[model samples]
Target: MKVLIITYYWPPSGGSGVQRWLKFVKYLQDFGVEPVVYTVENPKYPILDASLEKEIPKNITILKEPIWEPNNILSFFKKENTQQSAGFLNPNPTFFGKILQYIRANYFIPDARKFWIQPSVKYLKKYLSEHKIDAVITSGPPHSLHLIGLELKKALNIKWISDFRDPWTEIDYFEQLPLTKKSIRLHQQLEQEVVEKSDAVLVVGQTMKENFSKFSKNIHVITNGFDNDIDSTSITLDKKFTITHVGLMNADRNPISLWKAISDICNENADFTADYEIQFVGKIASEVRHSLEEYQIKKVLDVGYVSHQEVTKYQQKAQVLLLAVNNVKSAKGVITGKIFEYLQAKRPILAIGPTNGDLAEILKETNAGTIVNFNDVENLKKEILQLYSSFKNGNLESKSNNIEHYHRRNLTEKLAHIIKETVS
Candidate 1:
């Protein structure tokens, strides 16, 4: 079976968005499905990791078309050499920034990539007429890609699947966008159309599935998972009781309570403080840095934005992996792609988020780690001390269960099954 995947994020454009489809495409052939990737020829990626290019499967078709984004025009107003940061949704914007956000929200409709929809539909219509594709899949956050899929389906009557890595209107930063009442209604209208029109709707978590269920009964929860390709048997653990977080730490995800708990523990127990280190492996927001300074927690290391190849090494080495969901209204629904990787790392995880959310359920099921509520500093301190004591006794480890279900190849098989069912 041949499926054409339309996505905005792809290899060499690193971060969470690229991993799901990239890994899916990597293993699809094993399940008797061939993937043809269609992405922008030149993209204004917020973050770049050249190492990810090595993971693209060989002998697969990759089609690219030039995209012109409004960010290019907006860049003139900002400082030179200032790249756009992901997950940094500025809650409070300057006057000029607010104006830009207003224009982006209202004029751009779904997103800055809205311009790509018509062109992509037109281009893919021609390509599909000549090619022998069995079905089509479109992944989005730039939910505009779904618009392309909708048009293609309308034009060609193709079997189409709309994949939502994150919710459209329910995204964490949606409220922060300076949107008018009309724009808000338009976003909802478009979201409803995409959800109801697609042959299948794929979501990353149960919360997303629930959010879209009202629109489509053919919703599937194919959570982002880890590839079991890393050989961590020979890797050595870190000397210190290191708590490492491996992705972007925006202001919303800043673990203030955890920082206070760590500080409290350090103040009460000098020996524990001496053996503790808090390490962050990606971009850190200024607010997070300020919190660390406020806590007087000096044993810190920031290895800014390492390649995905390097992430597994850090995950394997750490005494405890830190997973902090963004403390927003949608905290209960946020399940990051890193959690499954942490499970595969086989290290005890220390997560800070809602205790009853999707992430908490996964942790409980896998026996991966303990989760404390965002405000539960006392519990956080106790958990940290217990882990520290275990570290000292050389008994700290994760007894993750049912993790085989989340392997990349296995997930691809499930995805292939869905595609087969959809096309049949």
Candidate 2:
């Protein structure tokens, strides 16, 4: 079977955005599916990891087209929002920034990438006439890409699949955006059209499946999986009890209560103060920085952002990995992509979110980590102290069970089955 995947993020554009499709494309050929990638030619990515280019399947066909980015042109008006990555808007912007934000919210409609939709449809329309593809998969957040899929389906009556790595209207920031009632209604309408028209709709979590089930009868929950593992032969674990968070973090995910608990730990236990260190491995919002300071947490090793190659090492070596989900209306469905990799890392995961949310369910199924609710500062402190004691005893590690199904190869096999079903 052959599938054409239309996505904005690809190799050389790093971070969690590219990892999903990149890993899928890597192993799709092994599952008897030929994957053709269509992406932007000149992408102005906020983060770049040239290392990811090596992961692309050799001899695979990759289609690229030039894109005119409105974000770049709008940068002069709203430097902060323009520079921000998708789904992560600046928590606080200047007065003028608010104006641009309003413009972005109302004018962009689906997203700033809306401009790419028509051109992509025009480009892919020509390509489809020439090449033989059994199905077309549109991966989004630049949800406007789904509009391109909608157009292709109408134009050619092709089998279409829309993959939502994250939710559309249910995304945490959507309600927080400066969108007017008309804009909100428009967003919802488009989301419904895309979900209803697609032959299959893919989401990353169960909550998302439940939320979107009313729209699409063929919704499938295919959570992100980890393909790579790090070698821990030479790298020694840090002597200090380290808690590390990897990937892009926004204000919504800032763990204020967790920081307070850590602060209390540092204050109450003198030995803990000397032995504790917190590290952030990617772009952290200013809100997170202020919270860290408010707690008087001094020991920090923030390596801003690094490549995927380096991230795996951090995941493998940290004494405990911290996963913080957004505390918003959509928090229940929000599952950070890194959790799968953290499971593969075999380090104890300390997560903060709804105790019964999808993330907690995964941790329970795997027995890889413990989760404390957002306001449970007492339990948060206890969990930290328990981890600290384990670190002292030198036996703190994750013993996950039944995780092989979440491997990239296995996930690709499942995806191939879906593709076959769609085409049939």
Candidate 3:
């Protein structure tokens, strides 16, 4: 089967989002499928982790089109280099940037990718005329990818699959988007259309599937998993009570209360003061920093974002992995993309966020981590001290059974199955 994937995030970019589709494409051929990817040429927001680009399968067809992000144009006038591995325009927009956002919010039919729609629709239509494809799958957060799939399905009669890496309206962080009434309404209408028209819809978790099932009957849950290729050898340490958290750190997911407990414990206990490292890898939110300060935990270390290849090094170094969920009811359904990688690292994880979420369930099932609630600062502090003591006393270890279900190959095979059913 020949499958065309319309996704905004892809390799040369490395973060949790890109890994899903990138790894899916990697294993599609083994399941008797050929994948032709249509992705943005220069994505507006990108964290360039080139280590992941090496995973893109060879001999696969890649269709690239220039995405007209207005923010990029203003950056050009400002003498900014938009092509850096860290993709996209900076968040602190210039005067032109605000105007561009306004136009995108109001003038664009549904999404910011409205500009790319005309070019994508035109280019893809011509390409489809000459080539044969069994299916069309669009994965999105930009959701513009779904628009591309929707158009192609209408014009070419190709079976379409709309994959949501995150929920649309029900997304936990949707409230953070400062969208106008018109933009919100437009977004809802487009979302409804995608849910109704697609032959199949794919989501990351059971909770997301349930949330989406209210909109459409054709929904499936295919959770994210870790890439087996990440080498877990670089930071193999013998004695260090290191706790590590990777990926984006938004204000919501920052466990401020837990930090307070940690700081208090560190201040009171001479043992914790003598041997403990709170190593935060990747981006850190101001809220987390403030909490760390409030707790007087002066030992906070920010090892700025590193390449994907280097992530395993840090993971291997960690005695306990940290998984955080924002303090939201919607977060219960969110099974972060980082958890799988943490699993592959084969370290004892410490989940400190939501108590009832999918992350907790996974940890309980795998016995991979010690789970703690967001508000339970006392218990969180106890767990921290226990883990620290275990590391200090050489007693910390992973007791979880193997979780074969989360292997990337299995997840990709499931993706292939969805494509087969959609095309059939």
Candidate 4:
């Protein structure tokens, strides 16, 4: 099977978005599928990790085109970088930035990357005509990439799969955008069209599958998995009781209650404070910083924007991994890719979100750790104290089971099966 993957995030585009298909592509050939990647030549990615380039399959066909983005121009007016990893929205935008956001939300429709869709479709339409492709997979958001797949399916009647790393209308920040009713309707209509028309719709979680099933019967839940190149046996745990979060902790993911719990514990127990450390490995919203300050918690470490290679080191060494799901209506389906790596790190996980949500289910299945609801500060404190006790006893390790199914190679084999079925 020759599958052409059309994506906005690719090699050197360091972040969660790129890791999913990158790992799938890395091991696709072992399952008898040829992976051809289509991505931008000059992408305005928020983060860069040239180290990821080494993961690309040798001799794989990679198609590239230059993309023109408005982020650089908009950044000057916004007074900050517009292309933040994991859709890091500025909570307090300047007056001029609000105007830009309005234009982006209402005018751009899906995203500013709308410009790339037509050009990509035009190029791929020609490329598909000349190649022997079994199927085409388009990943999003920038959900605009699905528009390209939609157009190609219309033009060439190609077997297309639309992969949603996150939901469309149900995304956590969908309401955050200053969108008018017409714009909202347009987004919904486009999303429906893509879901209904694609041969398959791949989502990262079951809630998304259930939600999108209203539009299509071909929805598949293919959760993200961990794929670290480093040997895990060589890495050692941190000497301090480190509770680490390895990805974007935007305003939505801020666990103010958990911070308060930790703060209270710090004041109560001097020894606990002495041995405790909190670490954030990527971009965090200012709101989170304010929460930490409001709780008067110290010993916070900001290892700003390290490469994936470095991210795993932080994960494996941590005494506890912190998984914060967005405390929003759509958060039930919002499973961040970082959680898989945290699971693979085999450290006890401490989560804050909906207890009955998808993430909680995974944690329960693996017997990895405990999850406290967003408002449960008391439980957060109890969980923390228990973890601290375990650390002191030298028995703080994750007893995860059935996690091998989430390895990159196994996931790719499933994807390969889907491609074969689609082609047949």
Best by lDDT: 1
Writing each residue's lDDT as its tens digit, candidate 4 over 1-424 gives 7999999899788988899999999999999999999999898877889999999989899999988877667766643545453367677877876787788888886998888988898899889989999889999988999999999999989899999999999999998889999999999999999999999989999999999999999888889998754577898899999999988889999998899899899989999999999999998888999998898878999998898888888999999999999988988777889888888888999999999999989888888888899999999999999999999999988888888888888888888888888888
lDDT per residue as tens, model 1, 1-424:
9999999999789898999999999999999999999999999888888888888999899999999899899989977965445368565678887787788778998999999998999899999999999999999988999999999999999999999998889888888777889999999999999999999999989999988889899999999999857787799999999999999999999999999999999889999989999999999888899999999989999998888889889999999999999998998899999999999999999999999999999999999999999999999999999999999999999888999899988998999999999999
In model 4, pairs of residues that clash are none
Candidate 2 lDDT, tens digit per residue, 170-234?
Answer: 99888889999999999999999999999999999999999888887899889999986557687
lDDT of each: 0.92, 0.90, 0.78, 0.89
Candidate 3 has its poorest 10 consecutive residues by lDDT at 81-90
Q: Tell me the TM-score of model 4.
A: 0.97
Which ten contiguous residues of candidate 4 have the minimum total lDDT?
Answer: 78-87
Better of 1 and 3 by TM-score: 1
Q: Give lDDT for model 4.
A: 0.89
Error of 4 at 392 (Å): 1.0
Per-prediction TM-score, please?
Answer: 0.98, 0.98, 0.90, 0.97
Task: Per model, state how many residue pairs clash.
Answer: 0, 0, 2, 0
How well does candidate 3 match the true structure in TM-score terms? Answer: 0.90
The runs of at least 3 residues in candidate 4 whose Cα sits more than 4 Å from the true structure, single-residue gaps closed, are 80-86, 228-230
